[model samples]
Target: MVNDIAIIAIVGGLTGVTTVLFGFGGGFVVVPFVYQLFLRQPVVANHALHIAVATSAAVMIFNAGWATYNPQRRRNLSANILFPLTLFIGLGAVMGSLLAGQLSEAVIRLLFIFYMLVTIIDCLVSRHFLKGSEARPLSALTTTVGGTAIGTVAALLGVGGSVMTVPLLRKHGFSMKDCISHANPLSLPVALCATITYTINGWGKIPVSGFLGYISLTTLAILIVTGGVGISISQRYLPKIADGWHARLYVLLLIAVLVAMFI
Candidate 1:
């Protein structure tokens, strides 16, 4: 229990920084760590990935919520624009969670690996393609469709929806801070829906101590505390960063996390 608490503290700190800086739910970072932790335990080894994904989703609720709340408190978010996106994404997250419950651990890991690689490559190459291009606003219908897609994919991969939401917002002419702000809020619903579904799915299946359907409440509590501190620290810097630098930094961080995920 002491060791777990220590590890959770570290994860929470990292997650807090990542959530605020990148508008992530911290799932991309948290899932891997949790998955590896689960893997080391014999009883839950067969369901490690499922547990990891579920737990990550549960933790993301707090991470993304705080990430969004800080900006909203500053009057940075546009509710008119964010509402529809959240509705669609939230709906999709529920469906995605249901789908995820049917997949095997190996399958989930492979899918997540594929997603990380594709996203890393896309982030690296897309900068050249986007040079000099102006962001264009999408229609309401388009936004809904896009949000649904992002939510679906995010839930499956045990991540906050920001990986896709930020790019979508950027494409629609939102500034870096605005993109992060919106992405952070949008992730809340995705994480919430996924968490509920995961909890329901794992009912009567996961029999590990300190687990409630794969979510470690003890870890969640530790992470929330440290994550809050991290968010508070990172929030001060996010708005000051330039858009280009934000993208570059995001790519670097993604690469680092992906490497960590595999290692």
Candidate 2:
């Protein structure tokens, strides 16, 4: 039991460190770690991944909220663009969370592989094309479509869908920095809604040590504490880092995670 607690602590520390460095990492790092840690207990292994993803989403509500709030206070962001899209995104997230429980682990793993591959390709091919574009007029149809797609991807992969949103916004003419800034705020609602959905859907299904719905409270606590501290520190240093270097790091991390998934 002590050994298990120690392992969980170490994993939690790593998750927090990565979360601070990147806006998201619990699903990428912690989910796999949890799976491996409980590999001998296969009955619980599948649910561990869901717990990690759901907990990570729950943790993001705090991390992303902090990241977005401080900046928004300093400079006015176009809330009008964010508000309408967020409404649909939240609704879709709930739907996606409900769907996750019905899918097989093999299907989820395959979907994760596809997601990682697409993200890697997107990072490589679109480096020069990532200029921030302007917000398009949000039509009801576009909001529903984009939100639903983002929510589905978020639920499956544990990413905030910023990878998709940032590019789409850039393509529409928003600047890269602006797109990132906007994406941060948008993630809050999506993550919050998704967390709630996963919780409700996963509630009797997950058998983690201290799970609530799909979320593991112990894991969420570790992530929140560590992630919060890490993000605070990283925010101070990230600006000094070169954009190209950051992008390269992002790609490398994704590749590493993808390889880990297969192993």
Candidate 3:
């Protein structure tokens, strides 16, 4: 038991570091890690990925809060755009969470793989759009679309939607830094809604012990502690290293990670 907790903490720490460096909370890492760790146990293996995702999101709420507060002390995020879109995202999140209960693990895994592939393709093909002029008027529409897509993906896979949202935002002319900064706060509504929906829908379905619905409280606690430390470290240094080529590298890395999961 102590060994398992230590393993989870180590993985969570690695995930937090990756998230900080990449500006994505470590859902990609956490999901697979949890899946593998619990693969042999009767510990609800089918829902491991979902639990990983939700637990990661719970951790992100903490990381995002820290990130948002640090920056807001200097300048406010563009909340005017974030507010309306959050409503749609919140709605979509609830819908997606409910849907997760009805879907099988096979279906959710396929959807997650498909979404990752699309994200990779978009990153490679639309690399040119990363530096275009910001479409201020279109922010609301774009936010809605982005939020809906993100919500669906988040509930389906337990990822925070950064894999999709970050690239999309960059394609629409936002710099990587601003895109990440904005996404941290933007994610809150979807996370909150999805967490709630998953809880409600998963009630009485998930076996209790270390779980609340599909979320594992024990796993969440470990992730929070390590991820928090990692976020602080990453925030202090990541901005300096994140350049134009980093996105392509991340795309390749994500693809490799996804392929490894199936193998």
- State how far residue 44 of model 3 sits from its true place (Å): 2.1
What is candidate 3's lDDT per residue for 135-233, written digit by digit as tens?
443365676776786777775677766676667667767666666666666666656766776666666666657678766788888887888877777
Number of residue pairs clashing in candidate 1, backbone atoms closer than 3 angstroms, sequence gap of 3 or more or interchain: 0
Worst 10 residues of 1 by lDDT: 126-135
Model 1 misplaced stretches (Cα beyond 4 Å):
71-74, 128-133, 236-239
* Residue lDDT tens for model 2, 22-117: 444355666666556555467677665666667767776876676676664227467766767777766766677777777776777788889889
- State the TM-score for model 3: 0.86
Query: What tens digits encode model 1's per-residue C-alpha lDDT throughout 110-186?
Result: 88888888887876676532331465666887678887888888987788788888766766666666777778788
Output the worst ten-in-a-row residue range by lDDT, candidate 3.
129-138
Top-lDDT structure, candidate number: 1
**Backbone clashes under 3 angstroms, per model:** 0, 10, 0
**Full candidate order by lDDT, most accurate first:** 1, 3, 2
Q: How many Å off is the CA of 94 in candidate 1?
A: 1.2
Show model 2 residue runs off by greater than 4 Å.
1-22, 40-43, 72-76, 127-144, 173-175, 206-209
